[model samples]
Target: MNTNKSGPQENIDLGNSKVVNIRDKFDNKTKEILAKRVGYLCSNPDCKNTTSGPHTDPKLTINIGVAAHITAASPGGPRYDSSLTPSQRRDSSNGIWLCQNCSKLIDSDTNYYSKDLLQGWKHNAENHAKQLIERELNQGWATTLPEYFESLISLELTTSPPIGRNIGQSSDGQFWLVLWDSRNAKYQWSKITEKYAEQELQSVCKYRNVTNWQDLFEK
Candidate 1:
């Protein structure tokens, strides 16, 4: 008889690997850990998509990155940056918990948040809201959009009387998914920001590889 010694998974060893370019630390460990903390999804107030990976256009950790440090490091630190040399780096408070899209928004402008909103958001992330891009911005009249909108105008929303996520028959008598499109309501994934059942997502959860919400919810 013969046996082989156990070896660690390649992803788990990312913290010590020398291949920085080839191996993404965040994907290997940091993402795994942070996802657990933030419920394996975007931490935005209303958005609720499970995060498959971590991002570092802003660095969260030195290696096995999860949260990006808003401030750049010194010349010879874990991630040296010439551009950051002149400017003072910010502390963790300056950093925001963002998904890939939100991270881009932050980089696009120094004044990303409204002055009144920014101060309140910084005071506590719980008070903040996830801002969508122009395309998905809450607006009116789109020639091409989801068909479910039409059904929503007429269909009133109702929950299953607070089973688990139902939160108990909303205080407003009933909880219904309102179709903003007001054109077609056959099927539309509403509230991309808030955490939702896997099935609630359209193509967004393409990687989920699950047949329906039960796949993740039963867990």
Candidate 2:
């Protein structure tokens, strides 16, 4: 069936599929779970974009995400599976959280984005959500991993004698480790020295009274 663009208006053929009458819609609970499963970010691994944010108007909010179906929501549409029941078609397992751009991109290229691949994306998104929840439950790190890591890298670039580079986590899950080295006026770092760096980082943290070397994973 043709995709619905505007309210109750006539369905327009978007040239991807032939227009039909049936419409498979997801219920509220399913939609909510789909959004939460990905932590409200685009499921596309290359585009983990946050879908919602503060709006220009303080009282409003902006959302650029969509809960797209792995299989077409209606028959005669892209990736429509005739084998699935109507209820199965609308199930949360069939949905993927995605930015508006990625949503359209997947629908536009059904050949490349198969149901199995989309399902894998959904699984990956859920795994990421689990990791996020675990991180949040831990004594609340100051920032997300990527953000914190990028900031550390930035600090490494600007500093002259990048010493004291290390990685360490607090007993309460506060993980922050960074160090840089400027040898012979040339920059050298231990981004690859993760194993050794951890040992050094813990020693540094202990020296600074930051956190001990005990196994404190009881959170």
Candidate 3:
């Protein structure tokens, strides 16, 4: 039996009341830019809710809304580009407005950590971001599967081309393809797929003999 309890007051205040710990003024600008870019709504195409909720914990670490950086400014990233004005370099094309769940989805995948999605989202959201800066931003948006696909395509294919087919998503609806990139460690696409996507999923599952997914398609 557990006697001790974690009260709501037990949580430490990080000084800011915002869901995401956006402290830096630059990051705040980034957030504002994203909010404008995404129209202050959730980025999932299927979810029309305002992005005014708590984001579940990602990495199973802490419970907070993780504001996703469309282009992660991590090590070995394209952060040193000399082609743009400093402001353009620090603009909304470099990021996105994903709710916590979608944020987690972004974190759990490589596409998020790649250039493909970053550039794709940039191209996709360019108009919106432009309007956002112009103060003509709307407040209605949701992330869609096409955005996901375009992002994946934005990846900088390695010198050695990455292995994996553009097959469809899983049926029980866990993954997008039979194997989440047989070339890399397995990670699944949480979003569901349609009939065409299902056919693609089965073909790859059978071709790769993805044990579980292959059997699922046979039926």
**Pairs with steric clashes in candidate 2:** 162-180, 165-178, 165-179, 166-178, 167-177
Measured by lDDT, the strongest candidate is 2
Error of 1 at 169 (Å): 14
CA error at residue 154 for candidate 3, angstroms: 38
Model 2 C-alpha lDDT per residue in residues 1-219, reported as the tens digit of each score: 997557743455555443455667788788778888789999998889999899999999888888888999887677999999988889887788899999999988898998888888888887778767755664332123332232332222234553535353433335455433334222222233445544554553455455643332222
Each model's total of backbone clashes: 21, 5, 11
RMSD to truth, every model: 20.7, 14.0, 18.8
Tens-place lDDT per residue, model 3, 79-122, is 33345444554565656665677666656656544556545554
Ranking by lDDT: 2, 3, 1
For residues 47-121, write the lDDT of model 1, one tens digit per residue. Answer: 444555445656543222134434323333333334532322333332334466654443455444432343343
Off by over 4 Å in 3: 1-26, 46-48, 53-66, 76-90, 112-114, 118-219
Q: Which ten residues in a row have the lowest lDDT in candidate 2?
A: 147-156
lDDT of each: 0.35, 0.66, 0.46
Name the Cα RMSD for model 2: 14.0
Would you give me the overall lDDT of model 3?
0.46
Candidate 1 ranges with C-alpha deviation above 4 Å: 1-34, 53-66, 71-94, 114-219
